[model samples]
Target chain A: MTATLTAPPARGDERLARQSAFSRLAGRPEIGALVGAVVIFILFFVVAPPFREAPSIATVLYQSSLYGIPAVGVALLMIGGEFDLSAGVAVISSSLVASMTAYQLSVNVWVGVLVSLVVALAIGLLNGYLLVRTKLPSFLVTLATFFMLTGLNLALTKLISGGVATKDISDIDGFASAQAIFAQSFDVGGVSLRITLLWWIVFVAIATWVLLKTHLGNWIFAVGGADASARAVGVPVKKVKIGLFMTVSFLCWFTGMHILFSFNTVQSGQGPGNEFLYIIAAVVGGCLLTGGYGSAVGAAIGAFIFGMTEQGIVLAGWEADWFKFFLGAMLLGATLLNVYVRRRAETRK
Target chain B: MSLVQLTGVGKNYGNITALSGIDLEVGESEVTCVLGDNGAGKSTLIKIIAGLHQHSSGTYEVNGREVHFNSPREALDEGIATVYQDLAVVPLMPVWRNFFLGQEKRKGLGMDSAFMRKTAKQELLDMGIDLRDVEQPIGTLSGGERQCVAISRAVYFGAKVLILDEPTAALGVKQSGVVLRYILQARERGLGVIFITHNPHHAFPVGDRFLLLKRGRSLGYYRKDEISRDELTALMAGGAELEELSHELDRGGGGVAAAAAKMLEQESKELGITPGSTP
Candidate 1:
């Protein structure tokens, strides 16, 4: 009953078109972002001589990775049809927990790191749990989490440290080793490249692979694109969504680790507005704001766009304030391009 | 034995009693058409059989074993696959991806993309559907093609019984014809098909048995030998209403209406319903 077809396979159907290589390329969600990246790369390369140097490339890449690393998780979350506003302050929350737990107990920094990991994952779990239980828009749920984490980050840091930031933990046991993994920079051809660059590339590679080549990746797209359809086909929507939220938290913890190791101190106010930055990077790279249509590589490209504009403006000898205006315009342009690409793909046949 | 049989199956959403007192049977190589207008409990029945909801009463048997499905997965495990009108696809995904969505074939750690893509293209071809490219987003396929893709997916997955809910309700005349062909194909392969639709014109040609549901209760059930196409059409459209409509047309209508009224008179006689009788 299963293997038989009504007819033998045909060689081709003239009514249906064979898509051209160009049209196929145009169908990628990241094509617009790729074009945008190229334009910016050329713009900066020609205008800012300093930006063309290898050392400056490392600096730009380092800055990109800071946003790029967190954007990786946020991209996955967005692709699953949700966004996390708490992602920004959650990084600070992680660092605060790790620092305060260690400072108060006088334990090895690794212990605090471990404690922070648990708490971070809990935040993710709670976000996912609340979403499925209440059936509320993820915006409302993650927004509430954002405010709560913000207040807690400030209050807890001020309460324990009696200041706006944590005490320097560089001298603590396990500090050197932790810093080596999270903050070490290696020189390449006399140019120091931040270790985060390596980590960011690796994270994006892994995320891209999962999204394109795994059953879980397919489920993530399914749950986000059309959840009822996914459920009808037996894709577990709640479990997948919750898992996506937790992925975001795990990255928040990782980002927090990098911040702490690189600076040896945690500021209560450091992470307040960075959540929007990660999202912006994702959107700039070609992730749809609505979910189910973006990619990690796109978000990484978006972060790279951000880094280029930030550094390029100064190197181009332009006033720094224009950076915001330029970025806002780029976001608008890239999104419009994505919309055009999607519409074209849908009508191609 | 019937692959799927329902005796007095029903469902209630709290106290509304969405459906009740329904009977159906589907055997190998048979097409059982469940015909009804909107709000005829057709969707509720599908939900029950597709494992979206449990019937509040009566017995549902698959392969001679009584079963209550808690989810679509359970029903699928029993070799019952459902192709919904519009809900069977995640639009943005490529056709190959949607073809193997929840049940993707894998080679080692990742999806076997080459194999899955080739199989998807071949399966559609086998079903007599010509696709331009399997990599194009399934959303780009016409509505009729999408339904065909979904049907082929069910067949490939080894569905013993395939339930198609309003598969052609949204299609044009030519497009509907395309789907009807696939129904016959599934039947030829010896899979039981439960096809739900309001249009008896579409149902009569391929259906081996017809179950008429009105307002959640069975009007009657008959094999193909027991009813003619005109009788089925008249009954599915609510015979009394069509009879009254024919009478009104007879009073002031033209040649077309007169011919239709004459045809209705014979169909009415065939169904043991006297023409011009008051409801």
Candidate 2:
């Protein structure tokens, strides 16, 4: 009976090996993003003369890192079958907390940063808790958080600083060290590379490792695939989801700190629309909105594409408004490509 | 001693009685087949035994000690693994990942991917399931192969009593045969198996004991030697009720319903059951 069900012997082992190898490469979640990045790079390199320069490349990398850091977290959350619509306002909220607390209390910048971290994590926990306990859709829960945070960010900033932006904290104690850690740039082959770029690489590396080399990685996939089934098999569904939301909050705090210290001031309305960019990067990186299938590295590559396009259009003398159109196209195209790749991989078996 | 035993076990949900007066014992190296049609409280019974739900009244024992499980985790800790019909597998996840989903091997804060992949492949092979690649998503496998994976996962996890819920209900004849073979292999390995199904044809050959259920109550439990396959099928289909239906259809003749009734009468006769006989 087993012999009858086994694969045909007529297909040589060598052929089977080759087929699997090809399928594996094609099946990778990041393959679409990688290809998109390469195409965007080539297109910009051909059309934008300045894009070929090292400094311009560094600038693109810097911009990519800004979105790449959070996109990694968003990808993981999405893979776990949840969304954080508040992610955008959450970044601004964190920055506002850090800046306002530093100036209002006249405390060390590091102390303000700590306060901001707590605030961000609390919001994330609330999102996760409400999602699990109320059994509400994550989209609605986070959307509510998004609106609340958005309102608070603006109102609190105005109330505290009497302006739409926080007071500059560049002269506060520990500000220099914080800047060095988060916002400082170093020369790389005569082109100054922002430290955020290094942070982005580290973030992507850690997120990728977690997704591929940890039990939590398996849980994320399982929970996203089928929560009830995963629970039946002993996977802690609620904990994984809560942890994922917290992970997003932690990333948002990091990004928020970077934004605050980099400029020494944060605008009250700076983060409202950026959440879509993070989601777009994840989707363009081949993450399905339905969840259970995606990669952190793919999201990183997706952000890289975003950075290149945003910079490429400016360098190529095209209107920056066209960037949104390009992003929309990429999202649709990447999703279609990912669907096709998944079908091919499954059918090969 | 029985690996798991239940006596006068019953469950109530508000005003409805889901199961009543169920006495079952699953021993080592044996298959105790629970035969039931839809709404026969099969799911409720398994949920109670698997610790998803507590029995409203009964003495449930594991290893001769009374036990009450609050959750499926407790049940698993007690080595009673339930492989649901859906297989409890993440469809989009790779085979190795699903195999070691909650129980993963770790090395220095990271999963031991190499070891997990190798062990998953070996375990599946040991269970006589051959896959082209363990890295492939489990959704790519056939329904039978997925069920086999779920069974192997339970066995690997040290389940002393394996309760399978309709493992063959959605499978084709060949796939059903494959799953039956796995059940036999599991029994040979000295694991007490509770094979739940409405199909007696699939159960009779592999089961050592048959427990027939109807309307949330056990009709009776029989050893393989105490009952013939025909008798088992007849009982599962409600022998007397089926006979009466055949006569009714015979009265409303000249249609497909009458034809089906005629076929039922022929089958009943072959099984040595006379029409209109007591159930």
By DockQ, the best candidate is 2
Tens-digit lDDT string for candidate 2 (B1-279)? 999999999999999999999999999999999999999999999999999999999899999999999998899999999999984688888899999999999899998999998889778877788665778788878788889999999999999999999999999999898899999989999999999999999999999999999999998899999999888988887877778888898888788978999898888777767654523
Question: What tens-digit string does per-residue lDDT give for candidate 2 at A1-349?
Answer: 2213454334333324565776567778889889889989999999999999999999999999999888988999999998889998898899899989989999999999999999999998999999999999998999999999999999988888999999999999999999998889899778899999999999899888888889999899889878888988888899999999999999999999999988999999889888999999998998877789899999999999999999999999999999989988988898888788667655555
lDDT score for candidate 2 against the true structure: 0.89
- What lDDT does candidate 2 reach at residue A197? 94
RMSD of candidates 1 onward, in order: 3.9, 2.5
Least well predicted 10-residue stretch by lDDT in candidate 2 chain A: A1-10
Interface RMSD of each: 4.8, 3.2
DockQ of 1: 0.42
Worst 10 residues of 2 chain B by lDDT: B270-279
Instruction: Supply candidate 1's per-residue lDDT for B152.
Output: 95
**Which ranges in model 2 have alpha carbons more than 4 Å from their true place?**
A1-15, A19-23, B244-257, B274-279
Top TM-score prediction, candidate number: 2
